[model samples]
Target: MGQKVNPIGFRLGVNRDWRSRWYASPQEMPGFLHSDIEIRDYVKKKLLFAAVSKIVIERAWNSIRVTIFTARPGIVIGRKGAEIEKMTEEISKMAQGKQIKIDIQEIKTPELDAQLVAENVALQIERRIAYRRAMKK
Candidate 1:
């Protein structure tokens, strides 16, 4: 018989030697792959969210509100707004010939709104005697 070779061993050696050293271990390989995929997915999702958020907030508020809050608007607006536009477009695409309405409020400060809303909600939830019933009360 000809020289016998372990196919799995050869394959493993090829995988270990031919690939980049950045992924050093077998355990690290999956992590590296997942991270790469995750980053791409995150970027896409971020763009979508930004687009939808911008459209919603813009539709909900008038030019005056936009002008007043322009400085802090960037946070809600997101990077390049490409993602935001992508998100809005995706929604519209899903609706298929019908326009989707998005409503977003433009607070003086978004960061502050979150803090205030959270605090208020917590207070309502925590301090309210009837809890659920008193939440709206």
Candidate 2:
């Protein structure tokens, strides 16, 4: 029988890496995992317009570094960097007071990003554009 496999998981170690990098004790693993999940979701929902493509979480000692890959860095950074500052504070709370450092990376060629291309198509469709026209772009 045919089976479906996660493309990312299939490529892990071959050419891909884990989105999260951390070492946690058995008793604390679950909490850390859940916190990672919540932080990811919170960032995505907060900056939905930012076109986030990937989020990499790296933890060491008592600090967490959140690297966000997005097509729109300005939206994530906001005016005067206020948005990112607020975001960092919120994520710190999510990490239970651990330091949160947010690093936003802009996608140089968003046209090649599958997520960005798909989101563009969806937005065109939402605007009542024909499917064929949407795909053409």
Best TM-score goes to which candidate? 2
User: Residue 72 of model 1: what lDDT?
Assistant: 38
lDDT of 2 at 60: 94
In model 1, what lDDT does residue 38 have?
Answer: 41
lDDT of 1 by residue, 1-137 (tens): 89988865578666533211232368655844554344334433553322211211111111101111121345444587553455456544443423433323455554344344454456567765566664453
Candidate number achieving the greatest lDDT relative to the actual structure: 2
Off by over 4 Å in 1: 1-72, 100-105, 109-116, 119-137
lDDT of 2 at 132: 100
**Clashes per candidate (backbone, < 3 Å):** 5, 0
Tens digits of per-residue lDDT, candidate 2, 1-137, equal 98999999999989888999999999999998999999999998998888999999999999999999999999999999999999999998888899889999999999999989999899899999999989999
Q: RMSD per prediction, one decimal?
A: 20.3, 1.4
